[model samples]
Target: MVNTPRLPLLFLDIDGPLIPFGATPQQLPHGYPAYRSRHARPAAEANPLVTRINPAHGPRLMALPCELVWATTWMSDANECVSPWLGLPELPVVDWPETSESSDEDDRSGLHWKTRGLVDRAAGRPFAWVDDEITEADRRWVAAHHSGPALLHRVDARLGLTDGDFDVLGEWLRQRLEAPSSKGVSPASP
Candidate 1:
């Protein structure tokens, strides 16, 4: 029997990646289209913004060769509100560290608050992170700290997840999964 490798983890953020905001009138001339899900509950009815979530994303996300994990501030609420809206099953959520005070140094360093936690969660497994807030600093940090192949794809907040974004993510993950794992080899010596 052939043993199958574990799928890479896909760290998904809500606000920017799923629930897009900050789009100007010029950017979205027709405004963001609202979508209604048949699986939506009465509680979701109260929140009109939930309609902004596209149900089509459910199938698109599921098609990716990775496990989807919620990495949003919405916490468990994402399972309640978003999952149903997207027709996605409840996935694992990242429990963030409770740091009451924001350190100016951390901000100035350009590292996102979620960067370290996501890397730790991957635990040497290949992973892809989707967020509008990803910066070059986060990419550098992940490349330096993570032993496995990682892709930190950034989405435009105004545009949300576009076809181009999905194409890039899918292609990267496909390539990563197809490539042989380089566990102990040093890139410098190769």
Candidate 2:
């Protein structure tokens, strides 16, 4: 059997994960409210995808546990919509492998594809994913749901990640960084 390597990755989502729901002083992305208005009614709770994101918390992402990369429906559009709002450089695109199929259809189920890319880029390593719409299905499907060397942090969209979240993430990365292969257990999610 061939040995598969695993790399640590940090996948950052723009709308719900990084940004909170109903956050004010919000920078409305181009064609945002209009685009969202077409979907659900105002104040609809089920539309998790249409929530707001907090720009203030953007800086904190720089200090996450692993290599930070944008993971959102925006895809490369984070360059314009999110980068300027955060006062940071545009996030690098996580591209699909060359062999993947392509069509004009706007099917944006690219999280798994991007996750696969990050794993291969890091050489079969582990990673942490931050997203708003990460259903229970996503958590169960990734790496058999053991919270192994890889991590998947599904943050709350309303409050955004807090200092406590950082502490947890930091501790996990610190342990792995300190010990290359130590099976240190991470604290369970709050």
Candidate 3:
């Protein structure tokens, strides 16, 4: 039997990275832009904010050389409401642990609540996390904790994902894909 190694994981956040918010009046001039997708359900079925997600992100994200996982509080709702808008298929969702006093301590320290779980999910595999909430604390923690190569690409909440964000992600993920992996993963896997 041929063993197929899984591709590197890309942990995605829906709120800020996919659905931008908090744009200043000068930044938006008009209200948030609406993106149309033939695959999406009727507008009446969706919350108005979900419409801000750019459908073009679907193809662009699909083009990236990694596996996508939803790492957002929106949970399965992201699959139900936002996926169609992006024309993206249902992706695995990260089930966040119940927040505890320790989590509060981390929050006070500027550590994002999602950081540890994301690292645990990676499980020594190469991974990238795209979120507007990512901070240097998160990056430092990931660098010290995750065994494999990782990229914590922070998208601006006001802009969501941009060409610059895509460029950075593509470069980092492509490099990880081309190089021989420490996990004995072959770069040539399809």
**Residue 23 in candidate 2 has what lDDT?**
44
Off by over 4 Å in 2: 1-7, 23-52, 96-122, 145-148, 182-190
Put down candidate 2 lDDT per residue, 98-145, tens digits, no spaces. Answer: 545522121353344444454454443455666555544344445443
lDDT of candidate model 1 versus the reference: 0.78
- Residue 188, model 2: lDDT of 32
The deviation in Å at residue 40 for candidate 1 is 7.6
Model 1 stretches with alpha carbons more than 4 Å out:
22-46, 100-104, 180-190
Pairs with backbone N, CA or C atoms under 3 Å apart (clashes), candidate 3: none
Clashing pairs in 2: 5-123, 5-124, 6-124, 6-125, 7-124, 7-125, 7-126, 19-53, 19-54
Q: In model 3, what lDDT does residue 34 have?
A: 30
lDDT of each: 0.78, 0.54, 0.78
Tell me the tens digit of each residue's lDDT in model 1 across 65-146: 9999999998998898888777799999999987645536558889899988898899999888899898877877788888
Error of 1 at 87 (Å): 0.8
